[model samples]
Target: MRYLPLSPTEREDMLTRMGLAEIDDLFADAADKLLKAPLDLPRHKSELEVERALGALAAKNLAAGAVPFFLGAGAYKHHVPASVDHLIQRSEFLTSYTPYQPEISQGTLQVLFEFQTQVARLTGMDVANASMYDGSTAAAEAVLMAHRVTRRRNALLSGGLHPHYAETARTLSEMANDDIRILPPDPLAQEDLIAQLDDSLSCVVVQSPDVYGHLRDLRPLADACRAKGVLLVAVVTEILSLGLIESPGAQGADIVVAEGQSIGNGLNFGGPYLGLFATREKYVRQMPGRLCGQTLDSQGRRGFVLTLSTREQHIRREKATSNICTNSGLCALAFSIHLSLLGEKGLRELALVNHANAVALAEAIETIPGVKLLNQSFFNEFCVELPGPAAEFVERAAARNLLAGVPASRLSPRAGLDNLLLVASSELNTDADRATLVAALREEAAR
Candidate 1:
């Protein structure tokens, strides 16, 4: 179906009005290699044909749910309950937006309120926002929040932090002109990060069950930050790991941000993921995104409303804390539903299952020749130093129907880490899957 919003003449007229002759004019500076001579392929298909063709293509791909997928770095593969989807699709939530209309948006507001509460409790903080786009953005926002709270601009990102989250932080920092210090990505290189702490530092960002799945003792680091009057920003891409490991907040994090994808959200390709952010009550005022609060209506009945909206619609352009409008509503809703289903006991059990699966996998893989398990401590995901290129090894594993995780080379090709492979095993993996990966590694090494 041609869903083009503008007609040919409409587009031409608009372009003329804007003093542009053609769309190609906008691409004049584009790389010559990128300026392909349009598609020299098949003709456009009708809607029905398009659907059938896409379905055929999709059928050729392996479904992670159907296999024991051990591919996690940021996003995770977990069993999402059917009820979460059903509840999220209810007419009240499906049609709502903004939640500014208190009378009509009560249900949405209440759901968001509960979501915020669960996030705060889960992260062990005083309060949490309704949500952010995902973990990376939340990490970047946390850096900004720290800058605001400390009136300082320097941010020290731990070497163990997720590369994607670190990159996102750098992107925002470059724009904010915030001084950024990044520790080198070293899976086993433990350094005196605290010694770097000073008055110029706004916050120190670190991850637990870090990018390589190695867990770092955050106590000393947190203590140093606190003593230096620097805020500790903890980023957790694997929120489920929190149930099994120490809470980042309890470890002395002033601001805790995490990816809520592992729990209530499915790994739909890459996203739409919910970002969970939490912090002390004093820092709430500097928090980005919206916040839901409970109040009373005219009849003294319970109600919910969007109390703190830092985006442009709610505040002066210059005074707003974040221009990140439109909180991650649907993803947040999915997370809320999932978290509600997990309760306290359920989450802990699930976390235990994940850890057990990972441990089982590590033990099996350690026996494989030329495949060195790089992490001695981890929760679910860990890095392995392979005899060959990690990307090549992952491809070989994929050919054998195993979704071996991200490769270190994919993170940095020139970083001289070609032999490094990042692997993950989640609750979805079975004993057979662990055996399969180990056997495959042994066979590949023999070749």
Candidate 2:
């Protein structure tokens, strides 16, 4: 049966008592933004009708694998091993909730403990949390953490940082009344982050193989940030790049946050992804999210427990390090399981394969007339300057059954980057995919 908490009379009486004439009066502040009419969706339908309608809508989408896919700006399409899915589905691993009681929740705690260890080792940081909502939120939390640690109110974001990530940090900072300066888009990776650092800045967030797929050397920026007493928050949208490039921590980053989706996670239509957050040992107190620690029982049996949970739910609202109540536990487990399956050597080899594929694709793209390769160095993704608007090229490619890459204009419409396209090549992509993309681009450019 349908449940109604209040009748029309009760709601009207409450509104009247509050000096509101109607329900809409309560939203007076946002009256301008209120919708004038209900949505165009069907009001109601039978179960079978709803299912058929949804199925029809779903069929309209072209499956990623059905075409020569190359789309990646933040979320990527990588091959997740079948075992990773098989193991994460086990009843114990699948049904576990928050580890409120370590004795009863040892299994969950241990998984988080191992996950933390793996993230720390992967990012070359002294420590890591269980996980965050996603990379964008993790980046925002890093900014907040920097504010707490440095007692500064300003953050400088690199132009190469993903627009979504920068906007996430900006939104949080606005609420905290902190200052966030976002540089203009740097498709060429020409922004000198060091020159923008100042004493008022709490941190400088930079991304390697940034949104434009141009790799950045964080060491110089890290050194400059240190000299200025500012923290270096490095964002990694493509975590696999760490396998081949220097880790943010090793490059002197004070905090490293990444989108762990590329590892052991599918695109899943852009979500339920993992966020990897890591930082130096000295700054553990200021770190956000859950931290798991290893310990021993009375009988000296090794165990794991929640070492730190600073969200408001666990502590006083004012004292909480973050308001993020939970971690991506299941996704973290999948990441750990996949990483375990692919030891160090395996990950490095996988990264090499991605790079090789990207190199070949880039070479093929450069051969196309009027198509210009943008990056001098990249891991698995790069941008190309097309002869026409990138959006148009993408549309043309789509008509030909080629899933072209993301366009810069789609990310930042007013940035005058309409001619630039961001293409990502992964292990899932093949020589056939590369040839298809090249042929599509060649045909479109010739037009």
Q: What's model 1's overall lDDT?
A: 0.85
TM-score of each: 0.88, 0.88
- With candidate 1 superimposed using the best TM-score fit, by how many Å does residue 438's alpha carbon deviate from the native? 0.7
Question: Quick one: how many clashes does candidate 1 have?
Answer: 0
lDDT for each of the candidates? 0.85, 0.91
Query: What value does the lDDT take at residue 271 in candidate 1?
Result: 80
Tens-digit lDDT string for candidate 1 (1-447)? 297789888989988998988977767777475656777788778989989999999999888876657788898988889998898888888877878788988788888899988988888889999898999999999999899999999999988888888889999899888889888887774756888888789999998888888898888988989888899998888999888888887888899999999887888888888888999998888888888988899999989888856444457477788877777898888888887888888889999998888888888888887788988899888998878887887887888778777888787666787878888887778888888778877876777
lDDT of model 2, residue 318: 74
